[model samples]
Target: MVRSNDNITSIENIQQAFRGVDYICSKQIATTLYLAFRLNKPILVEGPAGVGKTDLAKKTASFLNLPLIRLQCYEGLDESKSLYEWKYGKQLLYTQILKDKLNDIVREKNNLAESLEAIHQYDDIFFSPRFLEPRPLLSALQQRKGSVLLIDEIDKSDDEFEAFLLEILSDFQISIPEIGTIAAKSTPYVFLTSNNTRELSDALKRRCLHLFIPFPDAQLERDIINIRVPDLGDSLRFQLVSFIQQIRKLDIKKLPSISETIDWARVLLLLHADCLNMEIVRSTLNVFLKFEDDIAVVNDRLYELTQQATKEGHA
Candidate 1:
């Protein structure tokens, strides 16, 4: 049986539920989820990479105790890949096993025309749900108890694929020519995330509630670090977050994300480092930055970065 959001009756409850799962979110996120649930609409979450776009869906599933069905989008994604495909191997086996029955059904029909007509009657038999392979999109629709469907990185998919999602997003159903349209047994809570690689169609955007998540502020990042690494001393956490926030201000290919901050904190804990210093930061720079160029750029200003972080930590 599909569970309704009768339990999550208010925005405050949404915030509490997400907090219970250790996903610290702003009131905007809570309000977005609340409205999406109340309206039965999908949410389009747009933000830079690693701002917790994917984590939001995972945590929501945990909070609701529902199964999460994730479709990781990429270039050249299409309906057959995302929606459904015929189980050709199973269908072939079925056809072989049913050969005798087929012969018996056509025995009375002596003419070729009659035999062809008899086979046409059973054409749809092979195309039934039994022979259909459900992909993430179809699987979500088939769930009796509903699910949380996360379409991660929708922007990477081709324009054709984006258009293909229109019917499913607007109607909570998919049309299979062989089997006709399949509607959701229980509408899943849908979330589509984008890193803004490209602009999404206004048509697709129109069907969803838009939510933009930017980088966390210093205090919020500190709170997140505390939640993620509780054993870390407050002073170190402040310095690390402050350093990251400052680095974000510099022109870089990729800024350190909230997850990376937590990871750096864990690294410091393992090394038994109580504070951010030039030596420690230099060695652990790779923990946060992905590219060597980004590391070198930050390294050029390591002294200045360290001094500022230390000053902010003291203040």
Candidate 2:
């Protein structure tokens, strides 16, 4: 079961809030979220992909008992897609119904346009609620229940999309030309994550508290592996994490992350292996190394490690 926001007080509590995460990351991410909640500011997180940047927002929402609203950013994203748009088909149907009620052809056409215009005036009704279709930001605003709105991969978006968010964050309000403005009953706790594929505008960064998440060091990686794969014996856990860390240090195109450490350990546990040996490491190498090129690279390195271990054992 998850704890509520009322139970959270300090940065450490957020460590417990997101279980199975590294202590350094847990603290940094939790502090970012805590500060956001305390000051009503958005928290912007920048990191490499698969580094738990997106997961931090999810844990925060779950811990706080808030609704999670996720906006996946991509190339070609625009205001209408991010905010809202009218369902023209429904509007056309409403216009046709009004046309049927009139006798004169000219009057019928004029009445249809007036009727369509009146639909916009109904503000409270008539409009097909197409503009009412809630994107992440708007959904968070409309939520009477509290929400955590996560704008993911903001760097993938164009500058125009970033510009649009500035007003929404400051006011917690969105303006619809047909329906006027809508404001939140309570502002959502906002978290924005980026893979840093592109540089974000300074204007956007200034609106939020910021955090940069890097990959974990060896000790933290071991701790994370232990938590994620608890059944592994202490000796094996240390050995495998250390070995993976050593392997990651070599000249490889891709390095295993804290997550990959956990995955490798879990794979070992499933195999019921009690120790790290040449056969076990080679058999389960897939967890730590993903691509065929990475595997080939590690396999050659593993042979070297095996020879070193054999030498040490003989001595």
Candidate 3:
């Protein structure tokens, strides 16, 4: 949504914005981003992990020529970490200078309290270098040029952190007790991603333009894999993605997402496996399935799928 000379200013521009990648299908998503851009609303992308949620934001940033300011969320993230905090060490050094200038110890001690109070009033003077410790959210807001602020995995954060972001979401302003409120220099086009590990409050969802991304269908997945890894052959690409789709059907703790499917294909291509075989499949199985138990269960299913293929004369 961040304005630039790029062609992404309107929905019609999305095709050129993402020129090479053919997998971006959802007309709804392009419309959502376009509408959000026009309306100045933050776009919320929710879906299962690895379904191109985060990639969309990155691609948008690249297309718009704006810096991608990513705030990767986790459990127990606090305001000081997300917004800004004073540099206490620098403040301490200033106090030490005042200590050295005193000729009378008692008078210096009396003035110490007053000096500290005065110093506290101008706490911004002792701030850490803006480059050294700027939080992602603050950095985006402070930039004179519009930026793409990607808040990745919002569901991983706790309620307190979500509450903390409300003011920023509503006003694009972050209030630091030490430095007062820092408003956005250029209205950043915000994109928030969630894996839906848990349901976020309606209050948070209501503040932004919302969209749900799901696993791409067969044709879309094939297009995506081909675009991302062109070295892969047609037969091998179809086999690899079909195998992944079959695996997703079985009950498992972690199924390979679209990103993992691409990785699996890349691994196959790197190993010079032009076709699907037991040796190649077994070696690359670990790349797709993270859990040992999930791998063990899939081994049997893999044999079954291959056997079915052999019977159907498709192997």
Candidate 4:
């Protein structure tokens, strides 16, 4: 644990705290999170695209009252972008200032060798902390009061970047060639999320506590919608969740995610829909089902879906 606020003594405490922050956490989620806190391990969260993988890290930071430092990963992501980069403009500015003082030091040197040696003394000044711009990885490590580091979409990044993160995740430190190795002031709680586009390296997985967030079931998703949109009538909320659940089982191109379900719930609430009638759901199909083909496929079965959802909702 990095600070006094790490008082997450048990799984229930994590659930309670997260619920207080408007996040509904499952037992599995709470347990893994509790273990991560106690063992000081980075969690590698993998799942389908919008199952709240990234939001878990955000909410943890919120409930723990820690600063959230995010690094959105992409293809070709490297250490300089994710860890640190030299403030080249600032360094160049200082180089101009150093040029002004150049004559003072070299003028005192008798010969070329002596002047070269004298100039070398100021070489390190530009590479020092004053000229270094810390990125998310370095910034998280430097947070003395602790922080949450979210590396979103790790699968989108290159394997080299994944390998590069191994050292920082395992040891809570990073090596900078210009500055040597810099250890963390207070270890940050780290969350690395992947949409599972590709298989991750074993080395990277070994260093982290793996967690998979699958699509929520009807009851869980209904609860999520209820909390997120409290003003939504209970019957309509259930109907919408039931509709989403039914569609998820269909052989569609993209199953509607929990977020899309929530979006649909809000849409229904705004439309003042009192029930899951075919007309309203038909018009709002685009809210959750993204692909045209997906929408068309669901549209073909809209009558049966709406009937089942309405029947199940009232049941």
- lDDT comparing candidate 2 with the true structure: 0.75
lDDT of 3 by residue, 161-201 (tens): 99888888888988765456777888888999998888888
Task: Report, for every candidate in turn, its global Cα lDDT versus the true structure.
Answer: 0.92, 0.75, 0.78, 0.90
Tens digits of per-residue lDDT for model 1 on 1-315?
255787689888888777789988789999999999888899999987788999999999998888999999999888788999899999999989999999998999989999999999999989898888899999998989899999999999999999999888889888989878889999999999999988999999999999999999999899888888999998998899999999999999999998898899999999999999999999999999999999999999999999999999989
Residue runs of model 2 more than 4 Å from their true location after superposition = 1-5, 20-25, 97-131, 303-315
Local accuracy of candidate 4 as per-residue lDDT tens digits, 215-305: 9977788878878899999888888888888998999999889889888888988998889999998899999988999999999999999
Model 3 pairs in collision: none
Clashes of each: 0, 0, 0, 0
lDDT tens readout by residue for model 2, 1-315: 112357568877767756733333556666776787777888898876667788778877776778889999999998778887666666667667866443333454456677566544544544545525666677778888778899999999999999999988777888876677888778788889998888899999999899988877667776776666668887777677667667767787778877777787788888888767889889888887778898888888787765544443333
Candidate 3: where is the Cα deviation over 4 Å?
20-25, 98-133, 307-315
Q: TM-scores for all candidates?
A: 0.96, 0.83, 0.84, 0.97
Clashing pairs in 4: none
Model 1 TM: 0.96
